[model samples]
Target: MDKFDKKILDILQHDCTLAVSEVAAQVGLSTTPCWRRIQAMEKNGIIRGRVALADPEKLNVGLTVFVMIKTNQHNPQWLNDFGQIADEFPEIIEFYRMSGEVDYLLRVVVSDMKAYDSFYKKLIDKANFADISSSFAMEEMKYTTALPVNYL
Candidate 1:
């Protein structure tokens, strides 16, 4: 991608709601070319998808829990089952397979300790885990959807 494209991406990353004209003005481009660049990025999967970042407190989901899951199973079938279990819970905003002591990790958002306990029960009921360690986040210093434009 060119410098203009990088500028366009950086501008869009901050505020996706900006009009093409607004973005074009910021990046020193005409509307059509700016629009074309965005479209090309979308088609190429550089721009994955746009979303509104919701406030956890506003949604009654004030607690952020990082669940470190250890599992003995390492087969495709087990992985598929784990994927299904993860997909079943909307509270699980992020799920990942990892290397090292933790086999998997999940970022779970919930209303309270009680809610998390209920979620834990459901999770254990659905699948098997060798160890499930949960750590509640005290504060979120930085949470952002924007990736660094410098990487491109």
Candidate 2:
């Protein structure tokens, strides 16, 4: 991708709802070329998908819990079953398999401690964990979905 392509991506990542003409205006391209570039990016999987970012506080789910999980089992079957268990909990928005001390990490958000306790019980019932630790996020100083595009 060239400079114009990168500039287009930089703009889109911030506000994808902008019209192709608006994007063209910002990125110094005409409507047709800009629209074509966006379409091409989508087809090539560079622009994966767009989503609405929600406000957790307004949604009545203000608490964020970071759950660190360690497990003895490394077999594919165990991991698959664990994945299914994770899928069952929508509150657990982000799940990642990790290296070093923790086998997996989950980011969970809920109404309060009581709700989190309920989620915890449900999780323990479904999977086996060598260890699990949680840290509450008291405040979110900065949170953003935008990835750094200058590196590209």
Candidate 3:
């Protein structure tokens, strides 16, 4: 991508709600060219999607838990089943298969201890686990959805 494209991306990543004209103005481009660049980016999958950020505290899901999971069954069938199980729970916002001591990791958000207890029971019932440990996030020091565009 060129400098104009990088600039456009940087601006859009910060606030996508701006009109194409406004973005064009910030990037020193006319409406047509700026709009075309955005459309091209979307078509090429450079711009994946746009979304509104929500406040977890306002949503009553302030508790963030990092769950590290280990399982004896590491076969494909077990992983497929676990994926389905993970899909069933909305509390699991992010899930990943890891390469270290932990087999898998999940970032879960919930209301409180009572809610987490209910989720934990449901999870254990749905899957087989050799070990599962959790660490609660006391504070979110830094968080951002924006990605650096300097490499572009």
lDDT of 1 by residue, 104-132 (tens): 99999999999999999999999998899
Per-model TM-score, in order, reads: 0.97, 0.97, 0.95
Global CA lDDT of candidate 2, please? 0.94
In candidate 3, what residue range of length 10 has the lowest lDDT sum? 143-152
Check candidate 1 and list the clashing pairs. Answer: none
Identify the superior model by lDDT, candidate 1 or candidate 3: 3
* Per-residue alpha-carbon lDDT of candidate 3 for residues 13-96, written as tens digits (9 for 90 to 100): 999999999999999999999999999999999999999999999999999999999999989999999999999999999999
Residue 49 in model 1: lDDT: 88
RMSD of each predicted structure: 0.8, 0.8, 1.1
